[model samples]
Target: MSVVTVRIPDTMDHALRAAAADAPSLNAYIVQAVRRQMTLDAARKLAAVDAQAALDLDGEGDAL
Candidate 1:
């Protein structure tokens, strides 16, 4: 694995460390957080696409 350095606000860093006290490592905690965010983003995008498809279908029904 490659090493990446990031600079964060001290308060945020402290909060993360405290929240992640039960985690095995800070890196693992950050990775889990990022993965969770990605999943949430994907779900949101899927919902938006489904909503648009519903709207399109409704318009089609009106034209029929």
Candidate 2:
């Protein structure tokens, strides 16, 4: 629908081009890669917050 231009480092650009060569289109490959990374990053952040909350609750009784 909408088109956007992205600039990548020369090495990354070459790698992405090679990786997406078998993909139907460059856009599709980029979208898939971004979506996968976003999911993993969000999960990692949530896990860190959950771990911190558990640690805080270990010593505090009812405040948490």
Candidate 3:
């Protein structure tokens, strides 16, 4: 495992601590949050690709 340090404003720190209270640890909470964001981003990209494929197929109805 690797360790990284980050700096945030006092207000953000306060909010993080407050939210982490329900989590097992602050580090774990941050990791989970990052993982969730990554998953959401991937889903959004996939949806865009799917939408484009649908548009491309729409004009193929007459060709097929």
Candidate 4:
């Protein structure tokens, strides 16, 4: 694994600390958050592609 540095405002840092109180470590919390965001983004992209495919199919039917 690679290490990356992140900078955040003091207020956000405090919030993150509070949010991670129950977490094993700040890094673990951030990793979990990043993974969740990645999954959500992937799902959104897939939904957009499926929607476009449906629209393209509808257009093909109209052209026939």
| Among all candidates shown, the one with the greatest lDDT | 4
Clashing pairs in 3: none
lDDT of 2: 0.80
C-alpha lDDT score of every prediction, in listed order: 0.79, 0.80, 0.81, 0.82
User: Using alpha carbons, what is the TM-score of model 4?
Assistant: 0.72
| lDDT of model 1, residue 40 | 95
Tens digits of lDDT, candidate 1, 1-64: 6677767788799899998999999988988898899999987876777654654455455542
Off-target runs (Cα >4 Å) in candidate 1 are 1-4, 50-64
List model 2 lDDT by residue over 5-55, tens digit each: 888888798889899999999888999898899999987876778654654
Candidate 3 lDDT over 1-64, as tens digits, reads 6787867688799889999999999988998998899999987876777654564556465642
The C-alpha RMSD in Å for every predicted model, in order, reads 8.3, 7.8, 8.0, 8.2
Clashing pairs in 2: none
Candidate 4 stretches greater than 4 Å from native: 51-64
TM-score of 2: 0.60
Ranking, lDDT, top scorer first: 4, 3, 2, 1
Position 56, candidate 4: lDDT: 44
Q: What TM-score should be assigned to candidate 1?
A: 0.68
Worst 10 residues of 4 by lDDT: 55-64
